[model samples]
Target: MARFDQAEGLRRMLAGPKPRVFTFLSALKEDEKSGMLVNLGVTLARQGNQVTMVDARASEDSIGAWLNASNDQTLLDVAQQQRTMKEAIKIVAAGLSVTMLTRNADCMAKLPPEGARQLSRVFDVVAHRSDLVIVDSEINLEAGFPLASLDDSELVIQVSADPDMIKAAYGLIKRVSNRLGRRGYGILVSGASEKEARLIYTNMAQAAGRYLAVPLHYVGNVPDDEHLRKAAHLGRSVIDAFPKARASLAFSRLAEQLAMSARTTLGIEGVPELGVGLGI
Candidate 1:
């Protein structure tokens, strides 16, 4: 038998610098949200996008589920290591192409004296190393937590689409905008839907723009893809199984849209830039 040539494979997979932050609500129980995120991440990765999901919530039903995490380590570990955060995450993920931040609560209980400064530096480094730093913050982590660290992102996309959900998203968006210190722009839509995805979900988009006052780029509504079920059952990304599927296509389109948005609107050319300072 021959060696798997793991290093060679990684060199091929992570080739450029593209990082984006996308944190979701902790309100979603792990069983529901984590699978959706895994579905989203694997789909994006297959499109040749580098994505590192930080499980900020570390709840029983989040990225915490993957490592059997009892606490969250991404922000803390990244901040503590400073320059090493990017290298550490890439190395860890390179070791397992589809991995997430472990859930370690104690690690996040309180920040060190210069924790915020360390995190900002880490974000700068990771932004250059990966195609996208898809962070997952607790849905309602209040304002002023590390969620604001996404200040550097081109845009902070809020992910709820239902009207009732949009109502809650308003409060959430208000806090985030206050944290980021502006009107706040983001994608406001759901993850999964039925056949005729557009028809089923387009109304949600219309309502979001009307109510939330934010442009809601509709990431494709995932069908009840069997591969998603299988992967969740086995605790693996569907890309590791059915690399070519509707779910995969949706994420690819989403990644493309993000790249486009970054170039035109994120204030900087073809990458994200911090929009507002914490005025509130």
Candidate 2:
């Protein structure tokens, strides 16, 4: 029997669009990133999308802890030929798998040619198996942003309504636009109501467009819900623990919009059907 070529399949999948990597850049706190990622991951999974979260943040603010996960193997292991991507993946929640990038955190930011190529291959394998791969990126002194990853994946800038945070967020956009040239980016406002979130996005978007010539897409926001806190304290996704909460609903809507938008823009022409199980 002729065997299927997994490597060729991954190459083709990367060439197409159904499966996408979305690297999130944020000036928010660690807890905020972890919370938002958990909510977003669970929400997308509930909506029948397989999700793989790359915890590339520093070890101190690791997303693994948020999901009660401890990584014995990480992407660094893959980089060093110690483990395969499959071995590195830790199933945290239903339909959510996480791979930590603890050792290669700095390299991910700097992304030397060899580092970038190896990391890209790791991401490609994960992307081929999942519908959406969310990379929680970290800031670096050398490389500034994860250029190698950000260059290829859809970029989303996460911010809150705090004045300092808003300023920092804009600064991040400016730096990226200057370095990467003008590009469209998605903005996700956390800790704000729908009205407030829109207002925040509008303010940032206007500034980005006027000054940097970078287009910002409002991907939606998570409201300030007590249920969110409760879910976090209980070590579960808000969507799973508080399905009717404002934050949960907001995440669900965002996931739906993103899925639709990606499919439309990327043109899921020849991709295999992702029979994602609705697991929340």
Candidate 3:
């Protein structure tokens, strides 16, 4: 695999279209979130997009952990000048790579001012090198993201059909809105049929709009499929391991919709700037 070059990445940032960064927060189990991220990343990469999955949570259930990435090296190390970008990024497939934002979730908050700035620069370079960056993250106790740039990225809330999960998902949106103020968020329902997903999205959207005045876009859903679990057990994405599986088809469709959305929004004015210095 080719290594990431900082100079080239910087040039790309300046000359090419802005990369789309989507930070996902899940109200489901940890394994479910990790599985969704892995399959989605693989599907996007298979579609010929330059995709990078950044594990911002750094917990045992994070995407990095799901991929069995070494915690010793991370983007934080690169920012601290202890490791190179190439060393930090692990290429999982042709166009898919995974990197951990930090070894610990609280590490970002502990960084000094200069360190925080350097971390922001490192993240900027990494994001520039990819066409799509998928961030597996969680809002901290203070309802702030680990990186300031994530505050400006597209925020997606993942939920299931379970009542508890739906409630938790809505609570998450409320917490984020309380901190970030009014902003649109994408909704992704996992482990549900089309009808169920639509209903879930509608109810949640109505509540959000009526109470919080926040707009929620339905990004689509992933149906319940045992093939997803089997693929994960085989250390492969459903699209790759079980191409004809229902989950595989769902993932492909989801990836298509997300890619289309990204293209349509490309070069649009008023897109929030990313990779700003961290204040968290």
Candidate 4:
């Protein structure tokens, strides 16, 4: 709770004391989001922002399994009005030391209405904590449950990969644009080589700018490197494990862009009013 309540912790970096939220949403592809978040988490951590990476696709790091959350009530146990997001996040897991929420969205046909409500509130609390929250969700989006609640976030990142993946991602973007309105922003290129990714992104961005009138930027990418998979398997950040690698550096750059974008979007600078500045 120290970081959440500690305004000075952030003031040192910005002219204001408000927290910024950047949400990453991906189609239900396995590879796209997990890697994207791995890098995003490292970057946010490096930038002095306490980043909470949620496998919103719900991969098994749910609060129920954590001793930290078990000491209190789990997020699914809280009512929306009764929920205090700060306490929910305080329930830590092992390193990442992160609070991860993972679940298979494709099998929700059997879930009761109450079950759905609990899940919705869980994400709401997560959205409230930390400086930035990145969600890695399954591709199949239900109309009301997850997507509706995510509107609480400022920006949404829909990530995809390869030649076919590029087209698929754009299709998803064009569809989400109307429902999400103008705040619909940021296109992430994942698991693509520098040349292929650039060429594909150029075509997509040109199409979007000319038609949808949206400016898309690829903030993070994983160059099909094997080290990333190893780090994720070992539950360590690539930024720490492979600090000198190109992939890690690229991820860091992505985090920097995201941090700068959040600040610019929030209209903050010149040291936060909390009478402090960030050491970074």
Candidate 5:
């Protein structure tokens, strides 16, 4: 991969299109989800988009750990007045900023009014600074989506080829549609070939359309590439460690598509408009 000029990339993203935050809700295990988010974030950052990743997981496994970033402070620290969002963010590969929110007493509690306000403030600060945000969110449609993950942002539900994983993904989509109302959802399949991934999406999409009257959008997939595993073991993104690998190529394409989708969703031909407010 060619080296990207960070200054030039920021300028391009700022002048060309409005920024976007994509929240991915996945039923995959903690490690899998964390790895995927790291790959996506680094790929987007390398492609010249200023990306920030928010790790909102309840699991011990962390995206920050995968990126080899120190988690001295988190979003909770910002909420509790221990640190600022700017202060909490750890800069990682290709200038990707990450803030990890591990499971804690406060993280498990219902959102308090004051906490919500602090989080909103953090959201505003983060939104202003970055060209793209990838929210590695917890899978909990049972309580509706998080406020930071909502409003004018794309929602993606990551799925795998396993029967149990497909069932969980469908159930999540059904609950989210019921709670949040009918909306578009991007289905990103992992651990499968293009042909297999298409089949999985086709089956799930058909079921969602028939049973729930919901439309599922396919956001593409990553093949079961061995290089991804090796890169993960080395604490580096496949794009960085093995740029010619199959998974690296897939992630590059996915990042390009996501940027195009953001431009298409929010028209940015003229001056950029402010994004919707954070609602919990």
Candidate 6:
């Protein structure tokens, strides 16, 4: 088989209506993070948009693991010609698919330049085929994302009302700004009322602007609801299991807000050239 042309793949990625890519970094526990992503993804898919949730962490606590999608071959495997793209992305729900960046967290950093480029090509292909791509990721010890493209993707930090988690979220934003230079980030507060979420976002936004000169956007919040836990235990999304639940309503509203923002704010001109900066 012939090798994929990195330049061509990048050209195609930039030539058309680019898909909205949102990389989520969370201060919540692994399970909580995964749960939030699952509900959000399902809600988005329910709105008729083709969505793909990429498990870039690939850890036992990643969304893939939470969805029992860990056994699927990863994008790295596709890049290495060990698996086909069709075999890599698994459909977990209607209009929603899941794929892994790499089975091992360190594998990406160890890839050669050619291997890295190939992986980037695979990611570009994935993005072009979807309306939106949600990355459930974390910054590695090297202070970098698994893919360079993620560095340019819309970044959202999921935090909660707990003081410790709030502190950790700010620290994460600082760490990212220090590495990637000053840039805006979206803040989503989980397990809090609307008023509490606003307070958290305001305080964090002010602090970030004053200290790091980073702009923060309030991307809305999810409330504390027992229905969310019940739906999870039933292996179903909150919207599907309990559409009348407060958390379900919140997810639907969030999905609408995000989808509209994505369509209006992102276009072909906003598409970043992939595989340019290999690492962080």
Best of the candidates, TM-score: 6
* Cα lDDT of model 2 by residue, 1-280, tens digit: 1133455446655764332777788879877887788778888887888888887764656577666545658776687688877788888666788887655455454555565567667766777888888888855654355435445567778898899999988888787777667767777888887677778888987898888888787777777789989988897888889888877777877788667655555522121121111222
Candidate 5 stretches greater than 4 Å from native:
1-19, 68-72, 101-105, 108-111, 148-152, 266-280
Single out the weakest 10-residue window by summed lDDT for candidate 2.
268-277
Output the worst ten-in-a-row residue range by lDDT, candidate 5.
271-280
RMSD of each: 11.9, 7.3, 8.5, 9.6, 10.6, 7.2
Q: Which ten residues in a row have the lowest lDDT in candidate 6?
A: 271-280
How displaced is residue 31 in candidate 1, in Å? 3.0
Score each candidate by Cα lDDT: 0.49, 0.71, 0.83, 0.52, 0.72, 0.84
Looking at model 2, the pairs that clash are: none
TM-scores for candidates 1 onward, in order = 0.65, 0.82, 0.87, 0.66, 0.82, 0.88
Q: Return whichever of 4 and 6 wins on TM-score.
A: 6
List runs of model 1 lying over 4 Å from the truth.
1-19, 67-75, 81-109, 139-141, 154-166, 178-181, 191-215, 259-280
lDDT per residue for candidate 4 within 117-165, as digits (tens), equals 5666576556555566655543344333243355445444444455566
Write one digit per residue (lDDT tens) for candidate 6, span 185-261: 88888988887888898999899999999888788889999999999899899999999888988888888777776
Model 3 error, position 172 (Å): 0.7
- 90, model 1: CA deviation in Å? 6.3
lDDT of 5 by residue, 1-280 (tens): 1233455446444653333777788878879988988898889989998888876654467676666545558766776788776778888756588876634434636677557656756765786688887877754536454553343356788899999999998988887878666656778888887777778888988998898888777777888889999998997889999999888988888888777666564422121211111110
Off by over 4 Å in 2: 1-19, 68-72, 104-112, 266-280
Ranked by lDDT from best down, the candidates are 6, 3, 5, 2, 4, 1
Worst 10 residues of 4 by lDDT: 271-280
TM-score for predicted model 6 compared with the true structure: 0.88
Which pairs of residues have clashing backbones in candidate 6? Answer: none
Q: By TM-score, rank the candidates, best first.
A: 6, 3, 2, 5, 4, 1
